[model samples]
Target: MQPNSVSPASEKQHIVIVGGGMTGGLLAVLLAEQGLTVTVLDGAPAPVMPTGPAQLRVSTLTEASHWLLQNSGVWEYLDMSRVQPYDAMQVWDQDGTGEVLFRAREVGAQSLGWLLENGHLAAALYRRAADYPNLHWRCGVAVEGARREEGRWQVRAGDEQWQADLLVGADGARSRVRDWAGISGGARDSGHHALVATIATALPHNACARQVFMESGPLALLPLYSDPQQGEQRQCSIVWSGWPERIARLREAAPADFAAELQAATGEALGEVTLLSERAVFPIQERHASSYVAAGLALVGDAAHVIHPLAGQGVNLGLLDAAVLAEEVERATQSGRSCADSAALARYQRRRRGENLLMQNAMRGFQQLFGQRALPVRWLRNTGMRWVNQAGPLKRLFASQAMGRGADLPVRARPRA
Candidate 1:
C-alpha cells in the first residue's frame, strides 16, 4: 500500500517500535512493506538531510547494510553525495611493528563498507517511510511507560495510550522499552572513552580506512568527503579511545594541540590534522540484553547489544538485527501466526544471539590482548597480526567477514546477483 492508500489505524495489524533510530526505522519500513502496520515512536525529532561535512555521529555501514538498504528501496532516497565508501582497511599496532590489511578485491567486492552519517541514514529512512502506507511515525514523543495486557503491549507516552500486537525496543543503549519488558542487560565498562570528531588533514585519506592500536586504545580514521565550500578533499572522521583522564585531557586541549596529538598518534599518516567539528566524547562499554524477545516484545540495535567501537561494527550488527527480525516477523505473519509468535521470535533469537555474543567476546578479548603490557603477550599478538596479514586464505576470510558476507545472511542483506 502506498502512503495514500493507508488503512485506518483500527483496521491494520499494528506493531509499535520505540526509538526510531536507524535500526528501528529500517525495521519499521520492512514490516510495513510486508503489510503489517508499523508505528515508530521516537523521543527525538526527525533528522534533516546532511548539507555539509558529516556530523560527529556517524556509522560505518557494512556492505550488507548497504545492500539491504538498496534492496529495500531506501538507498535512492539517501543523499549519496555525503556517503563515503572505502574499499580498503589498514590496521597496525602502534606499540609494535605489526599490521593487517584487508581489501575488497580479495572478497570479489567493490567496497568493504561505507562511512555514513547516522543522521543521513535516519533522514533517508524517514523520507522513504513517508510513503509506507502502513507506517505511522511519531517523533518527539517520549514513551513514558510500557506494559503487556491481554497479550498486547500498551505504551504510555504524553497522555496517549498506544497498543500493538508487537513492540520493539530500538531505543538505544538505555532503552525504556527493554526495561518495561524486564529484559536483563549488563554493561561492562572498558575503562575507556571514545572521542569522535570530523577533521581536515593536510593529506587526503585516499578512500582508505585506517586504525592504529596504541596502549591507550584503538584510534580509527574513517574517510569522509570534504565540504564543497572547503575546495579540498582532505577531511576524515576520527574515533580515538582511551581512559577517561586521557580522553578528557585530549578533549579539553586546545584545537591545535589536539590536532598535533592526532597527527602524532596516527604517525602523521594523513599528515597534519585539523579539527573541523567539535570532538564529542562518550563512555566505551559492552552492553548486551540477555534475551532479545519476550512475548509480544522484541529488541533491536543498541538496545540489544553494543560492543566496543574499535571495529566500527556496531551499526552493521544493528542493521542485520533489523533484517533478520523483519524476515522472521514476515514469515510468521504469512504462516497465519501472530507477529509475536514465540516460535518465530525464538528462531530470531537463536539465529542472532550467538553471533552477537561471539562478536562481543571477540572484541573484549581483542581489547585485553592489545592492552597486555607483557613482552611475551605483545610479541605473540604482533606475530599473530603479521601472520594474519600474510596468510592469503585468512586475509580472504577476513575480507569476507568485514564485507558482511561470511555469516548467515538475510535475503535482503545478500548482494543481488
Candidate 2:
C-alpha cells in the first residue's frame, strides 16, 4: 500500500496538538520551528507569570530539561529571580540513622537541579511559542472531539474544526485525546495522598533539598527562593505523602497544629516551620498507556504515563517525551517521509516507553521498600543507604541519573559542543 505523503511542491505537514500546557506547548514550538504548521487547542486560559508568595505546585528541572528550554529559546522568557537552584540534596530514613548526601560539586556541576513554579514555566513556554509564525496557540478552546478521516486527523472545538496530518495528546492524565483515539490505559491508585504547600522555615534551607522517609511515606522539603525584598531565604515547598486519611487530616488541621506536626517530622532540622500558603491535597496514582502511539496520534507527558512523585522526575520525564517525539518527527521529515511515519513513531515509543516504565517501577519499589515495617528490612535499607553514600562511584551514578544525564538524550537535551 502507498503511504500518505506531503506534496513535494505544496505546503508542509500540519499537526494539531490538543493541549497547551508545558509538554504540548513545547512540542508546538519544536514542530513549528521545523517548518510544520502547528495549532494548539487548550481548554484553559493562557498562563500568567506567577507573583507574590510561591505557588503550591512546582517542578524540579534537571540539567537535561534546562538544556531543552535553553536550546528552544524558552529559558530567556522565564524570570530568573523566581527560579531556585539547589546545589545539594539530603535523603534519610526517619526510623533509622541512615542518610545520604549528594553535592553538585562532587559531579563537577554547578547545581543538582532547579525548582520552578508550574505557572512560571508554562507562561515562559507560551511566550516563546508565540514567536513562531507557523504556530497557532489557542487557549480557552475546549476540544470537543478528534477522529481520523481520510488519512488525516480532524479536531473539533465548538464551531471550529482543524485537519492535520498528526495529532498529539498532551492533555494530562485524563486526556481527551487519548480517549478519542481509543488508546488503552488505566490508573492504579498508589494507596496514598500528598499534601503540598509553601512553608517558611525558622532556619534557611541553605539551597538544599531534603527528604525523610517514614513508615507512612516520605516528606520532601524542596528549597524555594525567598522574596528578594525580604532578604531571607527561609521559604521552602513541601510535599508530604501518606495515607489518604492522614493527608486529609493534615489539610484540615489548624495552622498551628500543622506547623507543630511539620516541626516534629523534620526533628527541628529546619527549626520551627510555618505554613505560608494554602494546603492542597492530591491522590497519587500510577498510570501507563499500553502504547504511546497509534495511527496518526501520539501521547506525551502525563497522558502517556504517571508515576509516584518521590523523585520529582514527573515533569522532567514529560519534557523528555516531547523532545524525543519532536526529534523523531524531524528525522522523518528530513528523510522525505510523512511526519506521521509509522517507523518514526515506533522509534519514539521504543525509546521512551521502557525508560518511563523503568522509572515508574523503581519509584514503586522504593515506596514499598520504605513502607515495610519489618525490623530486618529496616536495618538492611538503612545499611544500604550508608554504604551507597560512602561509595563515591555508586553515589555519582545515582546523582547522574538524578541530573538527567544519559547517552540516549535527545539532541536538544545534549550539552552544546
Candidate 3:
C-alpha cells in the first residue's frame, strides 16, 4: 500500500492533507489506515522539540483524545514518561472566592486528563506517521498556489504540483486551503492576550491542575512531569491571560520580575516559582469558517474553527474533527459510497460544524460569565459555581464534557456505552 505502489482501485481516492503539523500528520496516518493514498505536504521539516527560549506549549489530553491516539496506533509509540496525569482539578477566583474542586474519584475515573508538551505529541505523531506505508511525506515544501480541475484538485507548492481526488485543510488558523477553496471565516478579537511560560515550583503538586481567575484574567498552572535533572524538582506550565497593555508590560519585564508577578498572580498556588523559560504572549481571538466543505475539499483543525482557550479545548476539538472526518471516509467506503462524493463530505461537515459551534458558544459563554467585573454579577457567578461544585452529578457532567466524552460527541466518536 505504499504510495508508489498504489494501483487503481475501482475508484481510487487520492487525498492531500496540507500542513503537516500535529493534525495534518495524524490525519494522514488515519486516512492511510483506511486504505486510502494520502500525501502530507508541509512547509517545514518534521516536528522537533524546541531548544530556544520559547515556552513549550502544553495541551490537556482528554480520555477520548488518548483513546483516539491509541486506536490510531500512536499511544504505544509515544514517550509516556514525559506525559503526566492529573486526577483532580482546582479552580478559584483570584479574589479568593468561588473556589471549586473536581476529583476523578467522584466520577469513578482514574485521571481527569493528561498534560503533554505540544512538541512531544507532535514528534510522536510524526514518528508514527513514518510507519504508514501508504502515506507520502513531502516535507520542506510550501503550497505557493492551488486550483481545482476536472473534479480534482491541482495543488502547486514549491517546484511541484500535487494532484489529488480531494484535499483536506489542516493548515491551522490562517489556512491556505481554506482560501483556495473559497471558504470564508468570521473572526472577533477577544481584547486579551495570553502570556505562557514554564515555572519551577517547590511543592509536590499532588497531580492536580489549578486555575485561578483574577480581575485581569485567568491564570492557569498545569502540572508537568518531575524534572529529570533534579529528582524532587517540580514544574508547571503557566498561562496568564490579561489585557494587551498589561501583557506587554509583563513580557518586557526582567525574568525575575516576571516570575514575581506570576507568583503574586497565582497567589503562590503551587509555592515558590522560578522562571524556566522566556515568557511568550499570544493574542486571544475567535474564528470560524463559513463552511467546512465544498466541492472536493474539506477543512479540519484550526482551519475550520477556533475558540477561547478558557477551557483548554482547542486541540481536543481539532482532534475530534480529524477523528470524525477519518471515520466518515471509512464508513462511506464501506457502504459502497464515493470517498470524494459531495454527499459524504457534506455529512462530515455537518457533524463537525455543529460540534465545533456548540463548544465555541459554550466557551464564549463561560468566558463572558467569568470575565465580568460587576460586583453583583461576580457574586452571582460565584454563587452559581459554588452550587455547581456542590452538585456532585452536575460536576461529573461538566468534567465529562471537559474530558471530551460528553453526549454531544459526534456520532462517529460515540462509544457503545
Which lDDT value does model 1 have at 89?
95
Q: Each candidate's TM vs. the true structure?
A: 0.96, 0.96, 0.93
> lDDT values of the candidates?
0.86, 0.90, 0.80
Superior by TM-score: candidate 1 or candidate 3: 1
Q: Give, for candidate 2, the lowest lDDT window spanning 10 residues.
A: 1-10
Q: Count the backbone clashes (under 3 Å) in each candidate.
A: 0, 0, 0
Candidate 2 Cα outliers beyond 4 Å, as residue runs = 1-13, 229-231
Q: Is candidate 1 or candidate 2 better by lDDT?
A: 2
Candidate 3 lDDT tens digits, 122-189: 77877777777777777677888879988888888655677788899999899989988888977888
Estimate, for each residue in 1-417, the C-alpha lDDT of model 2 and write its tens digit.
Answer: 111221321343388888888899889888989988888888999888898879899999999999999999999999998999999999999999989999999988999999989999999988887787777787788989988989988887787678878999999999888898888777899999999998888888999999999899999999998776444778999999999999999999999999999999888889988888899999998899989999989999999999999999999999999999999999999999988999999999999999999999999999999999999999999999999999999999999999999779999998665
Top of the candidates by lDDT:
2
- Against the true structure, candidate 2 reaches a TM-score of 0.96
- Regions more than 4 Å wrong, model 3: 1-13, 49-55, 408-417
Question: For model 1, how big is the CA root-mean-square deviation?
Answer: 1.9
